[model samples]
Target: MIPVELWPIASSLKGELLQMQRPQERFAFIIDCFKTYLSWE
Candidate 1:
């Protein structure tokens, strides 16, 4: 399970990505987020 503190960051990341026009950047952002979460874990 994810930690509570990460929820806001995740939501904000999603929101930011949603407003973006570049699909590649959005995908990379998501991959980076996953990498970050893995590192945190």
Candidate 2:
């Protein structure tokens, strides 16, 4: 589960993902977001 502090970020990411028109684009975006989050840690 995501921490409370990160809920806002998670929510915004979810909103963006839902707005994406293609699965490929969503998949790529998710990967990029994951990479960025990993780098932050």
Candidate 3:
């Protein structure tokens, strides 16, 4: 599952790109990975 705070930003950045407008786009967007890294680890 994906994180909460990152969902919006990821979707937003995904929205910004043409090929990233899909649900699985986050798979390609490093924002998700970055968010995970910046989280309380």
RMSD, one per candidate, in order: 1.6, 0.7, 5.6
lDDT of 2 at 6: 92
Give one digit per residue, the lDDT tens place, for model 3 in 1-41.
76897799767765666555575774656666678778957
Q: Give the TM-score of candidate 3.
A: 0.37
- The candidate 3 region of ten consecutive residues with least summed lDDT is 14-23
Q: In model 2, where do residues sit more than 4 Å from their true spots?
A: none
* Per-residue C-alpha lDDT of model 1 across residues 1-41, encoded as one tens digit per residue: 65798789778887999998899988888898789878976
> What lDDT tens digits, residue by residue, belong to model 2 across residues 1-41?
89999999999999999999999999999999999989999
Q: Per model, how many backbone clashes are there?
A: 0, 0, 0
Superposed model 1: Cα runs more than 4 Å off: 1-3
Better of 2 and 3 by TM-score: 2
For candidate 1, the per-residue lDDT at 34 reads 85
Best by TM-score: 2
Cα-based lDDT for every prediction: 0.84, 0.96, 0.68
lDDT score for residue 22 of model 1: 91
Q: Among all windows of ten consecutive residues in candidate 2, which has the lowest summed lDDT?
A: 32-41
